[model samples]
Target: MKKIKIYLDYKCFPIWIYNDKGELIGNDLPKELADDKQADEVFVKIQNIYDNLFINDLIEFKYIGFSSEIDREGYLKMIDDAVKLLKIKLGDLYVIEEKIEV
Candidate 1:
């Protein structure tokens, strides 16, 4: 039997964004948010965006089995298509992968 496995590193974006632009450093924020309370609010909003990412499923699929090799290949093609679509929409923000095993 052959199987396909896919994984999503859902936290990839928040981690990358935080490390790169989380300018909450050294008590220095852009003038617009120099106020500590406002900077904290902006930080909270960014966190909300990160949370929304996990709430939405780009494509929905559970473990589905195929009866024959031909069917398996066809389904795999569909998965490949889905992955491409996701890349277009998500812009490589998530660590995504697919694996086929026999």
Candidate 2:
């Protein structure tokens, strides 16, 4: 049996989009904020879009890692686990597998 491997790539941003005075608002930092000379003084907790999704438990397989790539065996395993855990059809997902000479 091939072992399943899954890699998670995270795009994270600050959790708080507002300024200290509670004026500016948004999920991302505005240009005004970026232009601020004191921008370095601002600090906020960061979060990933994946954090908003409740599928963490489903994607958190035993072979999951924080790398950008996974081997063929690992990818297959992840697909199988995802289908079984999410109770979804394999056809619903899009996957491309290729062979590398290296």
Q: Write the per-residue lDDT of candidate 2 for residues 1-102, one digit (tens) a residue.
A: 111112222343432233445443443334434543332222221123233322356556232333444544554454444334322322323231222111
- What's the true lDDT of residue 80 in model 2? 42
Best by TM-score: 1
Q: Which portions of model 1 show Cα errors greater than 4 Å?
A: 1-65
The lowest-lDDT stretch of 10 consecutive residues in candidate 1 is: 11-20
Candidate 2 residue 54 C-alpha distance from true site, Å: 12
Taking the tens digit of each residue's C-alpha lDDT, what string does model 1 give over 1-102? 111124223332211121234332232222333455633444344334334434445676333344567855765565456555444544534443454332
- The residue-level lDDT of candidate 1 at 64 comes to 37
